[model samples]
Target: MATFAELPDSVLLEVFSYLPVRDRIRISRVCHRWKRLVDDRWLWRHVDLTVYTMRPKVMWHLLRRYMATRLYSLRMGGYLFSGSKAPQLSSALMRALGQKCPNLQRLCLHVADLTTVPIASLPRTLKTLELHSCEISMLWLRKEQDCSVLPLLECIVLDRVPAFQDEHLQGLTRFRALRSLVLGGTYRVTETGLDAGLQELSYLQRLEVLGCTLSADSTLLAVSRHLRDVRKLRLTVRGLSAPGLAVLEGMPALESLCLLGPLVTPEMPSPEEILASCLAMPKLRVLELQGLGWEGQEPEKLLSRGLPHCMVIVRACPKESMDWWM
Candidate 1:
């Protein structure tokens, strides 16, 4: 009879990947053959270290040990409080990541301190990057390189990164190949910077703009002027909205539009009006209205008698019927 260790390397590697990282490490001590099988590159393709808080030193140690060239996605950081307020991703670990993870495409850091991590040390193969509630030094965000840092980058999500300002957005314009961009909870970004940054992304397809002071008309105009190819959009509005909105008229490729609102002001365009414009689009399929409570009953009534072509989605952001804005 064959034992567990007698299983082929292919099957063992696939099955062992289902175990937790710590459990794999524990099982590695069972025998040298099992250790060799557990250390396969396929088992380390996607690694998430955010299930619980870890010390900065320990995190780096693990990364240095298992940083595989076949890695595809890496997500690190949760909360800090394990004898340290800020969990650090060291420059050495970053160097190792660049050297080891040549195939890595996604890197997500949440609530981590990136003061020492070098932007140049990032892997060139990265296509998706997400930084949530991260802390970075001024010099880091302000640093400008002569050449493209992540030339192949395609998607970037910056959430609650306070230091990300117009300069960063302007810097982003250099990465013209990006297909998706999300900028949320960024207070320093303005309409000028947003327009300047967006002017070059002719290939951008998906966008989400939240936590900014941009006007709806100006933003729509900018999108029409430059990012006309965008198929899906989410723009959070603030202040007064006028009776007229700059809907994507010529954009036949657009499929979804989620307009998060500025309440129902007297001068504002009605939700029904926006829906009417959306319904006229050539290929638009989804129109989602968020945050704005129903200021009138006609829009709801119009929604009930919806047409066959497009979908009118009315969903609340903060639970149901409760006023909560992103």
Candidate 2:
């Protein structure tokens, strides 16, 4: 059997990479040769410090040792921001990265706000950014001067953010290379802003809105006509209407759709219109409907009659009192 000492340094580095960052640092103390091996630049390429919530001092120590090695990706998670000293301690950590990790390309911030983002330290090579519940605002997001700092920004994921605006998109319009965008937890986003904001994503190919309150039919129709290039779409419409169904019909290239929330009833368009639209969708493969209650008679039998060939997954709600059909 090959002893630990006999293994090649490449093999050792690969093995160390699998271990948690804290564990890798601990192993570095085993011996001088191993310490040097652990310090290898390749070992720190993708830094994910999510597991070190209990011992953040160790994260600080590792960052101090490797702040300058052309870091490509960084994901900082856990209770680091949930603690009492998060604002101060997190700021210090970000400051350290800004001063050292000059080549950072992708960043994921799972914190409360952006007050201490160390934005000035962000690398010029940055392209992808994901913010989870960050305290950023439309005013802050619309600052064109601040946006010039990330000229290469391409993809953005704003998950559970409270404030965003159509004007925020104006700052990103210069990014001709921008492609994918996701807006999750959009209860705060007004229908008008939601519509205007989507119109500005000129090069968008994929879009996802988790909790938006928009005119589903009209907004979707506009997207299908103007943003015909969109191949992937995910939305949750509370009151599905005929106009909204018409909009869905325009998405000729749609392949994957997740329609959450319930379909609106006894409203603008009739049930026949909605059913016809569902039947006409050709490229659709996966369909997820949550909290759906059909008020019409024999819904299961009616669906079995028309929507049998769509390869759909229907999850009707008990509230609708609609019996299941296998």
Candidate 3:
């Protein structure tokens, strides 16, 4: 009779990979061989520590054991309530990660106060960074020692991070390698900063600015002129009037667009106007309208007018529509 423990190390590891982190931890205690196999670096390649209630002691232990090396993608934080301990632990954790995981590429932090993390200490190998409700500045992305801090960084998502302002966007433009950028619930970025910052992102392809001010018209205009390579755009401005939408026509390569927020506001263009503008986009293949309900208008009837080739998705709930990307 072949028991599970009698299986080879490779087969056991393969089985361990499919287990949840908690289950893996429990199984590790069953035997020494299982413990070693469970602790293998390959098992922790894409680690998500957000599932655990992170205290300073627990965080330190996890970093020392599972995240010391060979960590490629890491999603951590949710220790925002740790008060005084957060800064110290976050600083120490970031420093340890920089030393241990030099090849780390993707990082996502949620509700983690990063005020104590030094700008120079950030890992330079990062390609994607997603910050949710984090307190940090764009200064962290600045070049150091004559080299870009995150030279390979391509994608950045700042969701509900009030500290991220227009000046931060200016600093972000330093990363010429950027490909995708998402700014959600960041209200401080105005036209001036957006124009100045966007001009530098010549290679930008996908851009999303949700829950932002109407002043983003200038920003979208800047994107049309500067980022001709952009293929996808998502926006949630208050009033995307016909004139404002004309800017999108300049994007020669645009393929998909999402219009969110109250696009039916009194100041906004009518559904007919919006449909006309979208039809003018020669390359547009998909149009998604979310949370925009107009009186005496059926969303289905509007789509039936034209757009035989483009895919149209209409959703009543804004959040549900955003699930496609966010």
Using TM-score as the measure, what is the rank order of every candidate, best first? 3, 1, 2
- Cα-lDDT of candidate 3: 0.75
**Could you tell which candidate, 1 or 2, scores higher by lDDT?**
1
Clashing pairs in 2: 113-135, 217-244, 240-264
Clashing pairs in 3: none
lDDT, candidate 2, 152-270, per-residue tens: 87788877666665566455565556777777765566666655666777468777765555545645765675566776776656555776766677466666665555544555444
lDDT of 1 by residue, 75-113 (tens): 887453344565556776767777877888999988877
Candidate 2 residue runs with Cα over 4 Å from true position: 1-15, 53-60, 77-84, 87-99, 116-121, 143-147, 169-171, 214-219, 241-243, 250-255, 260-326
- Candidate 1: give its CA RMSD in angstroms: 4.7
Candidate 1 lDDT for residue 290: 73
Please report how far candidate 3 places residue 98 from its true position, in Å. Answer: 3.0
- List TM-score per model, in order: 0.78, 0.69, 0.81
The better-scoring model by TM-score among 1 and 3 is: 3
For model 3, the superposed segments whose C-alpha errors exceed 4 Å read 1-20, 30-37, 40-42, 68-70, 86-89, 141-147, 294-298, 301-305, 318-326
What does candidate 3's lDDT look like per residue over 1-326, in tens digits?
Answer: 88996788888888887776668788989989888988888888887877666567766776777766768998887577766645333555676777888768899998877766765566778899899878874556543333466688899998888777877776776676789999887878887767777777777899998776635466568787788888999887565667888777646789998877654556676667777877778898898877777444476568755787789887664555454234
Q: Global lDDT of each model?
A: 0.73, 0.64, 0.75
Best by lDDT: 3
